[model samples]
Target: MTALSPLDKLMPRGYVRQMLCFPSTSAEVSHTLKTGLARVLADVPYLLAGIITSEDRKHVSLSECYQTLEDLYSEQDISDAIDYVVIKQHHFPPSSFAGPGIIPTDTQPPFPNPTPVFRTKLSLVKGGLILCVAVHHCTTDITGFGALLKLWASHCRTGASAAAGFDPAWLNRKALLERPDTSNRPTPASIPELLHVKGPDELTKIAALASQPSDPTTGVFFFPQKTLQALKHAVNKHIASWGNGGWVSSSDILTALLWSAVLSAESDPMSDRKGSNTIGFPVNFRSRFNPPLPPDYLGTAFIMTTATASRDDLISLSFHAGSSNDDEPLDSASISKLADIASIIRASLHSIDEERVRNVLLYLDGASGDHPPITLGPRHDGVSIVSWADQNIYGLDWGDIVGTCDAVRLPKLMYKRYPIVLPRVPANPAGDEGLEVIVSFDRQVFDKFRQSWPMRRFSTLRYYS
Candidate 1:
């Protein structure tokens, strides 16, 4: 049995599901996937292992298990998983594929007995196929998950004997549990990125948030390359005047933009809502290690960092309160406000260096039972933004039979305030490379979000039931 890292134990008990859409259907696709997965398991046997929880259910480990391809792979009619119109339009309508029909239901957490770490399903549409892979979050993070998909695609494209060289060392989970010397450990309070909700009241609030019903109006918004460039340029130009010679990334600007927009849409100006609105985002620490973890090292190597702004400050930055004209240039005050928000995000991420990472690891190492020194969930009124923008999900090739993926979709999240930033799609014929963002909200908030000036100014919004 391989013990999971402390951070892994903190992952929510659930499966991370991803859907890859292909423009062509094939009779042998399922067979190819099964064979490829078998080959992958042969090389990375831990993936086939079953997850075992500790007596108290506070920790988890992987146990070797014998499971066949039949146990993991299945085929169902396309209509059962998604609408036929999705194949024609090449874009999934919001909440259209949100159900569990596409993924393995048994993969959901709270396993009384050990269960397989991975599961897959394939559905063939009229002119296309949808491949769904669900991996337990405790088994790997998104980077590791992407690596598994890429390797699976490789095995499918080339014969198993073709030597799709992959390092088995990357699968070592214990590497993440390693820590610095005792003298170098920092106190838990030193890490501002973490929020300790150990009090009964705070824990109750978090439980309330978790058990809240999910909002139905999840919308997908696409922003083209030009618009992203414009937003970055505007922020960079404003910050350059400070003469500090530092600059913020496009991601920082986009995060600020979305954070402000979402908070604005949910803001009830009439209500006496005070306090800061925080945005928590995960920062990949794979490279922050002294020697730096391998690019393909397969384990969770990130921690959440938060950036906060006063509710009033965020409201002032909201596009809803900006100029009525969509095309009008941002006023000087607005530009400055945006630049400030982006700077806060950039600084918060930059704060997580090797020392801080080690400090967090040491802190979590002491956690037990249901209480950890830190909480990964977003604050009650805050938003959590997870970016898959750098993940190479769209580039996974399944040989000439299926070619490249046409698009990717994530299932509706249980947390309505959480938003995911998907990878940028390849440039279209018009030379526009666009990014897709999925956000969930109730009908009223969704309506306000759809009409928000940022949505009107920078993206095309699509809604579905």
Candidate 2:
């Protein structure tokens, strides 16, 4: 049995859904998939394992287990005429598609899966096939999911023998979590204090945020290679004027830009004078560790870093000054100045150094694993940004058998009521390196947001029904 880490024990129950769009159905797809599944079992056997939770629910472990291959990889057909382009042109609503492999189906009982992780179906449609891969979040984070697909896709392309070299990371023994000898040093940056949540009230507020309903919508925005370079150049030029300069990444600028747009669209000038606003980005810990966790570490190694400012500070001056109404037109120039916002984002992310990460591990180790390791978007006041700008999720290919995967989607399953931005894998070819920023907001807020400058500036926008 492989014991779960303290960090892993505190994660909420859920799975990550990755939908791949393969243009036009092919007879060879199923055969390629079956061969790939066999390779996965032999190469990454942990995918077939089950979670064993202690009776008191205090600890968790992975036990060697397996289910029938037929049960793990089932195929189904969608009689409807929905094609691949339509699925791409519009938002892939979590509810529209149903099959044996799709998760959270209406008929499944609560906590229904006997296995901790399983890939069950190949959804065949009229003009295309959708490959759905679902992995329990507790077992891995977003990167781990990408790694699994890369490995499987390799096996699919080169045959199972090519997968023999793949090895999964054993997460529990990472040096990042080892208690440091500090006989006389100040407490490393306190995770509890840095996160700012201490009591039952804060927990309740955070929990309540996820339960609130929103007229949520999904969107994909593409930033070509040249446009992205120009954006970073403009932002950095603007920042240099302030005499406070540092290396800023594309993720920082995009996250700041989205946060600024949400604030501009959602904040009410008349009543938001004293409101506090925040943007929280989940930083993947795989690279942050001193020695760094294995590239294939399948566990929840992430921490949310947030930047906060008053609503008045973030909104345009004209709106905050004395706008007669809440819906008055905002200044495009003022709204576009996001260098300062980007700096805050960059700093917040930079703060998560060796000490801060260790503090988080230490804090979770000492606390009761009764609630989510961290709370985001509580009380409808903050936004969460999860970046996959650096991950190669867009390159998973099954050779010529399945056709090339046009798009890879990460659906937002939790915190539906709150706005969350998922930056998707950029579209193919090196020059077309861009982002698909998916944002969720209330219907009213979304309406205002769509009219804002950011949405207007998008080269293309497809609002999901």
Q: Please, what is the TM-score per model? A: 0.90, 0.81
- Model 2 residue runs over 4 Å out of place are 52-66, 85-109, 113-115, 161-165, 168-198, 206-215, 221-225, 274-276, 317-337, 366-381, 410-433
lDDT of 2: 0.60
Candidate 1 overall Cα lDDT vs. reference? 0.73
The best candidate by TM-score is 1
What's the CA RMSD for each of the models?
3.0, 4.8
User: Could you tell me the lDDT of residue 217 within candidate 1?
Assistant: 72
Ten contiguous residues minimizing lDDT sum, candidate 1: 189-198
* Candidate 2 lDDT tens digits, 1-465: 445565665555556666776775777788898787888777656666766656765566666766556656777677375565676556454433534444423112255434456564677777787777777666777777777777777888888554434754534534446545533434444445445443687678768875776546544455454555666777676666667556577667666656656777777746646766776667776777767787777667777667776565566532334444444443334434456666777887787776766666666655656644453212335466676665575655667887567666645432243333333445454444566665656566766666555445532454443
Give the lDDT of residue 171 in candidate 1. 72
Local distance difference test values of all predictions, in order: 0.73, 0.60
Give the clashing pairs for model 1. none
Q: Write the per-residue lDDT of candidate 1 for residues 1-465, one digit (tens) a residue.
A: 456777786776667778887776677777777788888877777766777776776667778766777777887775555555554364676454555467665776455457678888887766677788988888778887888888888888885634666786677766665544645655565433454445678778779977887656777888887888888898899999999987898888888878877877888857554787777788888988877887777777887888887676677676545577888777778778888888989998888888766666666776555564456533544577888888787777778766788778866654564568887777866454878888878778887777776677888875434
Clashing pairs in 2: none
